[model samples]
Target: MRIELEYNARSIPPADVARSFVPPTPHFGRLLSRNHTLLLGPRGSGKTTLLKMLTARALNSWTHPEAAALTPQVTFNAAFVAADIAWGKQIEAVGSFDFNASRKDAAFVLHTLRAIVHAMREATELAREGRLTPHAKHLAIEITESQEEKLVALVAPNLSVRPALPSLLGLELALEARLDTINSGEDVAPFTVESFPSKISLLISAFNGVTGDSDRRWALLFDELEIAPTRVKTFLLSGIRSFDERIIVKLALAPYMDDAGFERNPISPHPLHDYHTIQLSYPNKDDARNFGEELFARTFERIGVDAPSLDLLFQPPEGGSQLGRRGNQKRQGVPEEFVSLAQKDTSFAQYVTERNLLSPDYRFNENNIAQDIRKVLPIVVARNYYLRRFDGTHAVANRSRKSHGLYAGYPSIVEITEGNPRAILTCVGPMAQDYRQDIERADGFVQVSRSIQTKAIRRVELLLTSLLQVVPLDLGGFDAGKGLLGFVDTIGRAFEDRLLSRPFTTDYVSTFLIDENVSDAVVKAVGMALNAGAIIHVPYPDGGPDTLLRGLRGQRFRLSYALAARYRLLLTLGDRISLSTLLLVMRGVDVGDDQRALF
Candidate 1:
């Protein structure tokens, strides 16, 4: 029952590495025009995650039993086309982004492109591995001093043999040769900056030669392509235009004005076409809340019923010393302020994102301080809050200016996930890497000055509490028979828990990188809610971090979408919220144990 969730690193390799994932479902036709469509989005959006998911799906589709039975021809191969970006200080625009850093990293870009072609070819060949000769079915790259030389080796002799070209210019030559082979005698018109479609027809013909079909679909993934020059953009657009039916080129757009075309009319075609776009939006409160629930649900399913997820983090010894680990707590009553009905479950386990999360098991005995067992959830929350905060602080901390500019924003559930479920995992991921140097400078972060430790701890607290606070909240409503569900309190309680349970405000900015103003704003917002009686605090009878019961009578407008298993109202602070209160109106289940089955 070892429940281990392993993700393909290449698929969702941290967004920092290759942020070019676009979901491939609908966005078809116009958006998903090509199998190789470029995903365009602002920086920090989950492009990488989406890519990883796409790759994972591709990989799974190749091997998964159900997928294999249905879609037999789809191949799954993914690679990271990294941006060897040139840093620019004076740029303030997004649409017309120039990624060409003064520094030269085009070599890495060239290598990445070659790898993309080879990797896709390998995936295509995998469907008939033993049955066919590898080189005969898929094209393999021959690295030479010149890309033209390499192209000549792999391509037909008749294809225009342009040699020794630097960088992506090789791709341009290949396109020309491909068209020249098929349209040799045709009176071809010259490529114009604005008339891009004719160029696409030529490219399409080239692809038709390779796939031997006019409608063969191809997708080209471009990560961090904005660094290329405008002329290059026009040229590449033209090259791809020669093959619109055969390819969809996807690329990342730097989140600045330059990336957006300088005031293109809404109704008109974007100067950059062939890309079907899926824009990432800033997460709203509801979005954040739903995302948490989604994490929980996915994790639970992944954890399954066998291996206890909690044990993954903190397993007790075989001769367990702690008594009643499975049942209700001791005689000491749960706090009166906590929600009451959420007590005594099958286990002390939390399923998060396909992982039954628990603290990493330390020393068997409590005596070993180095191996002290701790709650995995709280620590995960704490670390997330810390790193997100840190991301904020490092982004704008201009120490040389004598003023570390306004720590403008704190993390809004800055969830740093590496497809793993513990602080130990994140300690090794992008979130923790930023601060690793500081920790290394002093053996460990804690060993550093108190100021650093405090700031780090504060961020960890903020993020942790934010995550723990909400679920698919009962956004108030009523059932066919049940009277009301206090949707507001349900949400309010969730939010309150997020704030109170995690670390409050702190002065240290460098640690979690929390914005001073944003941190304080959240605190003030929580306080204002409490002061207004808009958020009421209830006692938990069971002493759990989150009590389950909701109020009896509440705003009844929200019942339509609320699911039964999770929706319950606490009714009143004075009343003992329980299953009995729920049983009165809950129609699906009968009062007695021998209730009739629901259809």
Candidate 2:
């Protein structure tokens, strides 16, 4: 059986969201509460999927240990207010009218009301079809003809076109036509658009009037608020407390500021005060690996196949002793690269001999080589392997035949993608698709060879680094997006020089700290990098505040692990350097009077 995985959750139909759903990390429970919540992470961080899974249609279709335990306690009626890219762009392009802000806001609020009405209709249909749980049956709401007319009159009294029929669907169409007139940029008289509070409070009052269930709870799950127009997005972010206590607002956005970078936009809500924040990406190595492995196992279980763990599925390169059986092989004294480099480079030989890895006679110290050297084998292997090919001038060495082995193994892959669900799946999805016949033949018993995993790692590397060209950014006078790739190359070369330095140092560069007083263009570039996941924030220890792109003055960040293989850097967070110093030292000599400097 060729198991197909749909990585994009938004593309999945609302009714089928549960069918494609993989149980989220433990953060799902926090969102089930009445408090407003924000799901923060870069794109492909499973934000949309988590929000969609909250709706009555998805909840009714979903069956899992976690869902079973949590759903019975869910009294609220959840509605998905999907603001996708196209719709968001349309909102941003609305014409300037007499009350431009008010009209644009009204358009957004009216669309939100339509989604809520649709949700209520869905719940009623589920109840009629006997698909809702006994407890969830009370969530069904029916809007009478009179109630629909009353809502249309209250919320959209100034629309040129009134509902042809007195029904919820007719009201939705009328609002749609009104929005179309606004977007058409025609001459229209100014109309009264209700404030968010007035509209929402009136809608809730109407709901209570119809259902007679005054104690009912409501959750508005807003997906992709990051792409929404600034006025609309900021209003939603800043006004979480203004809504009624019975209604909860859930928003999904990236960690960086809006497109208006570094202008002190009042968008970031206070965590635990305004809303409970749920992070979708794991930065800790151990946490990421555990989550990635379980996700792989559980995902395969859905197809009636017992998938092997990530460790069992990806065999490490033959050079390292870390993967157990490969270490105990009869032919191993140390990796072959060690012996080869010891003969050619006196520095590596002396360094290994001092550590008891090589003998006084310049041969293998077999007794000391097996267990004592296992701890440093990855660094040893990476440094020795790249040192041979690194020509002193360039930072990135030309790829040799065995260069891919440095990034192959389970540890490398998990760290490369930082256990992001979409990234992890991207690495393995290709291999699974390629080996579908083999998997079916063996009833899903399969192991991805090091070569195949290496290909996946390199593919991710190319895709990540290429983001500098693919993502267009406007940074006033700088064109920072174009300079970003060269900037990355300079950083990579600095780390490589450290790794291949004389006498072999383990303290190679891995992370970087941003200087507080850099040019605003540089700050904007770094912010864009963070938003693109090209650089990930390393948090402070012991519950210290991680202000990330907000307070970036002294924040530490590392290049995405996808570039680790490209530059021969290890998967571990090795050491930190000033990003400014690295750039100045690497390319400072090339600065001229006329040309613009990258730093």
Candidate 3:
């Protein structure tokens, strides 16, 4: 009856490891040409995760001979440099190291510097080992005098003639590094380092030989790329390109880079343009439905129970009509009940299943959608309004959403990059986590579990946002609630005038004035968000939807305090709210009522 889900990073499978949600680009093998393949996607579209997995797979242990012939494996160690930058400072000092050199001990100093550089880069060691083990807990031995002797002996022949002695021990590192305090936060002093670039070249050369068979000459992953200052970004990009041609680098950028003032980082002969750009799109509606269902089933397993996979749900009948209905005699009502859930469940899975509730053969039109809301009654009606409130950018019906918001700025676009089902699910985990955080930030929310939660004002908003985002052509109006009614004509007018800036367009955005010419399919979807109590609509006891037009600009396009106050009046005015909170009473006052007048 109830389920709980957890985000398990370890369980996430790699996209390149032979999976369905993602496919090796027809041209992925040639990703490392002077022109880099730049993959860009919205948050949770699996861009970063895919990169890590892709790089790993590209360096597979079982090297295919044909693959090797097509593109040579450029073995390189990967490290999250940007992530290091974000961990604050002491860690930043981790990148700093000592390269001491007394003139008499020049050879000895050279070896110590090399060893320290190795130690400084131990972050990649963890990634190399795949997982930590007891053996890796500590470096068994430090650079003793003997080991230093061996290092010097290995390169003795390469040293400059005695007449021209070098001041720095390891000439390679000397060029890029300098010893200085790293500004660590502890009262203790910061670690010093040799800031030379040549040392890295030598180290990468050594690593390339060790893992000669791998794809990335040196796989370096940079997560949280946007957090660094533009200057730092510019510098790092230059560093990777200049010193390491054999190495492959991957960067995890912020979700908003699509809006990343391109003008700021003008695309000229910039190095980043070389990467093959890719954007992560939300899973298709079919994939989303499966992902959601799988998550639900997994949660059930965590609690020591097992149920059907998402595939078990009855498919939406091919036509535009009701596919899953309880009253139908063809199959069990269990499927119908499973497909539809109570609107207020705020958990990640909420009250959703794979069943198709629309009756077969009927054309899906706006009024039909409205009728669906009416049929599902007050529970679905109120929640739909809430779903549209939170996320308004993407279309809501049968589609996956990458970035969500209802601001009327952009048209709905669905472009999917991942083809593997598991990878898609893996990508979604983070986005879902963001939604969960949003729920927590909302006023008076009570997260019951992973799949379910008690709805409050904010949860109601979440419900509405989800609905409005996916369902297109859905606009309506509600005057201060003389009754829970639709503003069909008004929604038509406002939309035609381009009044809805999306999620915040109108308190009764769902009911905004619209022309009757709007598509029926879009209307149906909006009705769903509306029925789910995802939007806020308040019709005056004596007012029409037009009253909302009085407020303009910033004041008009925000959570309506008047509507909230009015909705507040409706809930408390009624009979007791239910176990799962429900708005059963319509907004209005009783006439000719006594002091004991009840809603």
The most accurate candidate by lDDT is 2
| Candidate 3 segments whose C-alpha is farther than 4 A from its true place | 1-76, 85-181, 184-199, 209-216, 236-243, 257-273, 283-308, 311-599
TM-score of 1: 0.35
Worst 10 residues of 3 by lDDT: 406-415
Compose the digit string of candidate 3's lDDT tens values, residues 1-599. Answer: 22223222223433233222222343234333433334433233344444444333323321333333333422333332323332222332443433122211232223333333333234333344554323222211223334344443443233221212221244334311321111222111111112323444454444333333322344445545544444444444444445456545565553232112122234322334445443332212233333345443443344443434322222221221221122222332223222332222322113222213333644445454444432332233223322333233421332112212111100000101122223323323333344345545778542222222111223323333343444343233244231222332222223312211222121222122222323343334333333322222233355422222222111111111112211211111111111101111122223233222111
Error of 2 at 376 (Å): 3.8
List the candidate 1 regions with Cα displacement exceeding 4 Å.
1-45, 52-81, 86-116, 127-204, 225-243, 254-259, 270-276, 280-282, 285-599
| TM-score, one value per model | 0.35, 0.81, 0.37
All candidates: CA RMSD (Å): 20.0, 5.4, 18.3
With candidate 3 superimposed using the best TM-score fit, by how many Å does residue 538's alpha carbon deviate from the native? 32
Which candidate leads in TM-score? 2
Tens-place lDDT digits, model 1, residues 364-458: 33233212112222222222222222221122111121111111111111222111122112211222233334445665222122233223333
Tell me the RMSD of model 3 versus the true structure.
18.3
Answer with 1 or 3, whichever has the higher lDDT. 3
Worst 10 residues of 2 by lDDT: 390-399
